[model samples]
Every structure is written in structure tokens, then in C-alpha cells.
Target: MGPNVHIWRHSRCRGAGWALTSPRARSQAVPGTPRHPLVLTETAAVSLLNCLFLPRVAEAASLPSALPLSASWKELVAMWLPAGKASGRLMKNSSTSPLAEKQGQTSMEASSQSVQATSGYPSTSTSTSTECKPQVLPVIIPILLSILFVACLVLNSTSLWIFWFHIKRWNSSLILQFNLVLMDTLLIPIVPLMVTYFSLGNSWLFGQFLCQLKIFILSTHLYGSIYFLTLISIHRYLAVAHYSTRTLWKKKSFLKKLSLFVWFVLCIQGLPLFFVLKTSVLNGTVKCLSIHQSEFSSVYLYYSIFLVTISFLLPFGISLICYALLGAIIMKMSSTSLRGRVMKTKSLQLIMVSLAIFIICFVPLHVSRTVGVIVKYYNMSCKLLLQVEIAYYASWVFTLVNCCLNPLIYNFSSEKFNESFSKSLRKFRFFK
Candidate 1:
């Protein structure tokens, strides 16, 4: 052969070998290649070029389909040329040089895969981390809450009976105690449902209406219990600080009206909960006490913060001031007789028990709930979310146990309440 013809034949053989060995070419290979090293016929070269260029032609055709017919052909040609050149160079080199073609295709595939993998992997990991599971409250919470439910039911029931029928005289203190008992009684029935909910891993079996009702009752009880306790402290203050003002609080009718007013206000305050509170599926598990999807979640959060502040913090502050003033008065009083000293001691015990109830039962709940509201509104990190969830539920158990503690408080602090309770028990032959 002449020099130019020999060079053309040599180039055609190299190009054919490269095309046959390429990744894309191997995938599209016909089954009739000879068992000799790095050789190709003209027919094989044309087939490989057609296979490689077909996909690029389809991609180029799709671009103009999306554009208007009057769109500039220059832009269309500009976009098509780069993709066409890239495929063309691959085909040309594979056809010309077999050894370089295999190495180049392998590197290209590896780099493309690495780029795709690097981009793809983090997205999956990020999604997994962001979907952190809701915190699971400790199993002991439901157990403890169940125990409190039973004890609260019995104690609050007895307290209600004694105040309603056993006690002969109903003073402002007894009236406030009766209201407190009534709140506890109303709240106790829902505790078993709550126990079941927590025991079943926060899955709410109860329907939506009951879920809303439970939330409303619990909220009402929370505020009512605190408000009444504060009222009792204020009553004690009035009795001690200005003994002459006894007749005003002494009237049963006035105390009854005040208690009624408190109930009215609490019910009004809690009406919003009916709209906000509902049962819904979260993370594929049914949950109760979650706010329904609304444009007003932020509105509800602010309202809740306000309600807690007014109903809890304000009363808490008032109770502290009243108790402090009462403590000052008791210190100044003359206690020459043993009976006077005993009465003074009992009064001090009452004050201490009230303070203990407020501090232990309500403070943690309010604090945790405040943190929860902030976390929910601001979309905090998963770690902060889990922490707030744990605190909120743990403190909630403490709050639920308050009813059981109140009866003990009454028995320990109030001489009249103890006598009435003992009489009622003896009448029932609970203790012979």
C-alpha cells in the first residue's frame, strides 16, 4: 500500500478497536464480532457511530420542541454543538486509538458516578436527620400518672362529699376548698384516658371530640386550681391582716359568687382550646393534644403564653405577696396562750403547704410549656425539640399529681377539714 492509504487503514483499525472496547460501545455491541485482537469492519464502525449519536440527536430535538418555532436558531445551535462535540470526540478517539479509549471511558464513568454520588448521599442523610423521631416519654410516667389518677379520684371525691354534705358551716376558705375539689374531681376522670394515651406510646385512641374535651378540661383545671389556691391565700391574708373585714368574706353568698365568676372566666379562657386542640396522626402514630393544622398556630401559641402567664404567674405572684404579708402579721401577733401559739403554728403550716404545692406542681409545668411554645413557634433544632418534649411531659405528670397532694394538704393544714373528713369516714365506717 502507498503511505497515505496505509496511514488511513492504520487509523481506521485503531478507531474501530477503540469504539468496540468503549463502555457505551460494548453496551450497544452486535453479537458477530470476530475473535481477533482490535479489528473492525466499515459496517461495525457505522453501527457504533449510529448508536452513540442517536441519544444526542434525541436530546437536541427535545430542546427546540420546548421553544417557540420563531425562537433564534443561533441559541438552539449553540446549546446543541457542545453536547454534539463531546459525543463526537468520544466516538472519534475510540475509533482512532483503542488503548487510550478504554482508559478515558473508565475515568469518565468513575468521575460522573462520583459526582452524582457525592451530590445524592448527603440529601438522604439530611432528610433522615431532620425527621428525628418524637421523644418517647418514660414508661414510668404513665404508671405514676395511673397511680395518681386513682388516688386523686378517691381523695377529691371524699373532699367533695365532705364539703358538700358533711361540713355544716361553709366559710370563704371552705368555699375555695370546695371549688378546688370540684376542679380536681372534674380533672380526675380524664387522667385514665391520659394514662392509656401515654401507656400506648402517646397514641390517642379517643376520638377527636373527646381529645378536644380532655384538653379543655385539663387546661381549665390547671388555671382553676392555681386561681383558687391564690384566692385561699388572699382570704387568709384578709382574715389575718384586717380581722375587722371578716364580715365581707364571711358571707357564703359572696364566696359562692366569686367562685362562680372564676369558673366563668376559666371556661371563657379555655374555649379557644376547643378550636386548637385535636387528635391527629404524627409520624404515622395517632397523637392527642396536638394543635390542629391552622393558619393560627402562632396566634394560639401567643394566646397560650398569655393565658399561662395570667392564670399561673399572676396568681403565683399574688399568693407569694399575700403569704409574705400574712407571715409578717403572724410574727407581730401576741401569742401568750398555748392555744394562740398552736393556732399560729397551724396557720404557718397551711402557708408552707400551699407554697410547696405551687412550687412543686405548677412551676415546672409552666416553665417547660413556655419553652415548648418557643421551640414550636421558632422551629428549633432536633436536640432542643427532644429536650423540650421530655421536660414538658415530665412536668405534666407533676401537675397531674397535684390533685392527690391537695387532699393531703387539706388534711394536714386545716383543722376543720380534718374533722369533717374524719366524721365522714366514721359515718361510712371506713375507720371504726
Candidate 2:
């Protein structure tokens, strides 16, 4: 018999109310007992017994299952002895220990917290965030740009050639029309680049310098077109409203100086685009004119707003006022001589054509651009930002339609344009 058997039997006897001697007395009489005939010292026996049963006691206590009788005996003995202090608690009476239950509850709470964290909010990481991309107008934009580029190149080139070679008398309206055609011709070269950009999903393959140049040139074209249109409107207004006054509208030198002044103002206004417009890599792709919200965003925002006001809104207002006054004067002249009425009728037709071109080509673009600037600098929600991006690009492409449409407007509205175009086409054998 060993000390483990003695400990077991001693626990059984204690449960049965048997009186046990002290460990010292038990060691002195252990060799004389019937069950334990071995002569082991008290300290050595306790050491051996602890080495044998302490690990089992700890394993049984840490688990959620109920302890066996032998483990429970070891645990109760360990509770009264100081040597078993290092061993952890045991599940003696219940099926599960308090520590084990608490651990399980904590694990469940952690799992639920992880789930809530994932499902509660939108991800703010750049990799997972939603970004606004340009809308793909599959057939409309590419086709329109293609046709417009060809027509604008041919018509504007022909107009410039005729203005230089054939049309010698440069009236105020003729000079303004020449400037308009010049602006349109300058803008026509950018259309192929734009077509490639949009066709490639708005990815700009050109270098950063070209990107900045493209934006600068486009901005100049937009305001230049508007300024010339406004000048044309004012000329028509003067021709109708103040027919007797001999002002600068009849002087070739004054008209030339005015054109130069308009160009200077537009160039000054567009100087910021050369500095502010830039290309950056977004989502592993190069994007042009992509202004992000930054410390300078407000500065760019206010500048952009001012540009739109001066270039687009102001010209639009001036054109409207001029046309309105011209219309009233023409109406009053309806009861005058038949020749005067016929001339007023032709003027009204031309005014209507100019207004239609302005509204159709520029209005949607400026409105969408204004909204986009607001949404961009202010950091609006993703959905509205996406919508504004689509509208802005679509209207941008629509505005380019004006480059080609202006020649048509001039052909129909001006008798000189018609005569010049006809003579040029016949000279080039386009019409026999």
C-alpha cells in the first residue's frame, strides 16, 4: 500500500465519522496497520502523494464537468493543506465551475460585439469606400464628338480662310463672328483628346502638363465663346435700338481694340487654371481635373464660383437684356416702312438664333458645373457626388456641341456668311 491509498481510505473514514490520528502518529504506526505494511516517513509520504494527485485535482477543477470521487478527495485534502495552495479551484458539487461559466459568458459577449461592430457603420477606409466615377454615355457622346470635331474643323477652317482672303470689310458683328470662329477652331483640336479620355473611362493618359493645358484651353474657349456671343448681342441691340447714333460699332479700329481687350480679360481670368488644374492617380488610374477637398479647396471653390459668375452668368444676363431690349425695339418698328420691317424681321430671327445657341449649349453645363463645385468642396454624400459628376461630364460634352453648332447658326442667320460659305464651297467643288 502506498500513501495515495492511505489518503483515499482516510477520506472514506472521515466521511464515515471515524477518528484519525495525527500524521506523526500515523507515520509511527503505518507499518503495523493491516492495509499499509510499508514503512514510509510522514514528510516523504505527503510529498509523494501531492506529486501524484495535485495535477489531477487541478485538471478536474478547471473543466466544466463534475469532479470524480478521487479528484474530489484530493481537492478537499488540498483545501485544508498549505502545500496545495498553488493548485487552482475545483468543481466539486456543481456540474460547471463559476470561473468556467464566467469565461463562456465573456466569450459570447465578445462574439456579439464583433458582429455589431462590423454591421453598424459604413467603412471609411479608402479601399472599401465608394467613389464617384464618370458616367459612360456609350453612343451619344462618342458619336456626337466625332461628328462635331470633323464639322467644326472643316467649317471653322473654311470660315477663317474666307475671313482672311475674301471678306475685307470687318464690321463690329463680323469681327465678333471672326473671333467666335477662331475660338471654336482653337477648341476643335481638344475634342479628339477629350474623346479619347471619355472613351477610356475618363482615364487621362496624357502627362500632367497636357492635362493642365487642356483644362486651361477649355476654360478659355468657354468664356471666350460667351464673351463674343455677348458682344454680338450688343451689336445687334445697337443696330436696332440706337440706329441713328454713330458709335464704335461702325469703327473697325474700335472693334479690333475691343476684341483684344476681351481676349486679355479672358486670359487673365483663366490664368489660375494653369496653376490649379492638375492630374493625380486615383485608384491606380490617372484622372484629370480631379480637385479633392483640402485646405485650399475653399480657395479654389470661391475662385471657381467667381469665374462662373463673370464668364457664364454675367454674359448670359447681358445677352438676355440686350435681346429683350432689341425685341421691344423691333416690335415697335413693325408698323414702320416695309423695308424697315423686313430688316427688323431678319434681325429678330438672328437674335432668336443666338439666344437659342446660348441656352442650349452653355446653360446645362454651367448649372451642372456650379452644383458639382459646391458638392465637391463641401464634401457631400457619395450618391449626390456621383450624380453631380455624371451631370458635369455630360454637360461638358454637350457644351462642345456649340463649337460645331455656331457655324450653322452663322450660316443661317447672316446673309454674308451664307454668300461666303457658298462661294467657298463652290470654289472647293463641294457643291456644283
The models' CA-based lDDT, in order, is: 0.72, 0.70
Off by over 4 Å in 2: 1-139, 291-296, 335-338, 412-414, 426-432
Per-residue error at 30 for model 2, in Å? 71
Segments in model 1 whose C-alpha atoms lie over 4 Å from true places: 1-129, 290-295, 412-414, 424-432
Q: How well does each candidate superpose onto the true structure, as a TM-score?
A: 0.70, 0.67
* Model 2 lDDT, residue 296, Cα: 55
The TM-score of candidate 2 is 0.67
Total backbone collisions for each predicted model: 2, 0
lDDT of candidate model 1 versus the reference: 0.72
* Residues 190-259, model 2: lDDT tens digits: 8888888878877889898888889888988998999998988888788767778998786778999999
